[model samples]
Target: MAWQLEGTYFENCNCNMICPCSTSGLTEPATRDRCNVMLAFHVDRGDVNGVDVSGLNVAVVADTPALMSDGGWRMGLLMDSAASQEQADALGAVFGGKLGGPMEGLGPLVGEMLGMESRAITYANDGREHSVQIDDAINVKVEDFVSPLDATGAGVKVSGVGFPADTLAAGHATASTVNIFGLSWDNTGKNSFSAPFAWSA
Candidate 1:
């Protein structure tokens, strides 16, 4: 089966202004003892084995060791409540790394699977800001870092990093909170990144 997905992705993590994990390729220890993060995606266009999955939202919540590459992570997946069973299952296969794609790179790091759930997910990207609300489980919003020297107000970005996207816009979380899977955090004012992503297999 062939699958393709294109989306806007963003994440908020319990790290300083610029997360070392992003630049260090997950080799450096996080600013904190643990890395608590929420990855949210809004699929603008997608298909898996002939099933359309456009306009759907998905999220991954993770708690990893300070040095992510050491590979001990507890993670859970959240699928949009609006999805049909077939759609959800298809997405699960792709995101769970069952089907070869970018996410497969992450499969080796997960030590525990907190299981998947269907929840109401709201994702918004209004150019300068990105926000996501997953039912009562998570709430977060990030604003891009705009350089005063640049008149166009584009976000300060970094490229050639080991991430899902080729380039990532640096940002900070204005409001962040999470309570799910026995993990809780208030990462307000922490590190954040946003980018457009495309994955196929």
Candidate 2:
């Protein structure tokens, strides 16, 4: 079975501005002793093994050790409530790294699977700003950094990292809070990033 996804992605974590994990390829220690993060994706167009998944949203929440590359992450997956059972199953297989896709690269890092749930998700992207709300479990909003030197207010970007995107718009979270799966955190004013992503296998 072949699958592909093209989407806008954003994340917020309990790390200071310009997260060391992102810059150091997940090898550096987090600003805090642990890294609690929420990553959301808005699928503009995609399909999973012949299942249409366009316009849907998915999110990943995780609690990891300070050094992410050291593995042992407790993670959960949230699927759009509107998805049919077939769609949800397909999404789980892809995002859970059960399929041989980009997400497979993250498989080794997860030591605990927090299980999956269906939740109402709201994903929004307005220029340099991105936000997501997952039922009552999570809420996060971020704004990208704009360099004064550049006349265009484009976000400052970093490239060639081990993240989902080839380049990510560096930024900080304006507001972030999470309380789910026994993992709770308020990472407001911490690190955030956004980028367009395309993954297939």
Report, for all candidates in order, the number of backbone clashes: 0, 0
The C-alpha local distance difference test score for the whole of candidate 2 amounts to 0.91
The best candidate in terms of lDDT? 1
lDDT for 126 (candidate 2): 86
lDDT of each: 0.92, 0.91
lDDT of 2 by residue, 1-201 (tens): 899999899999988888888788887999999999899999999999999999999999999999999999999999999899999998999999988887798899999999899999999998699999998899999999998898987769988875688899999999898998888999999999899999899
- Model 2, residue 201: distance off in Å is 0.8
lDDT of 1: 0.92
lDDT by residue (103-162, candidate 1, tens digit) is 898999999999999999999998779999988889999998998898987769989885
The residue-level lDDT of candidate 2 at 163 comes to 69
Alpha-carbon error at 142 in model 2, in Å? 0.7
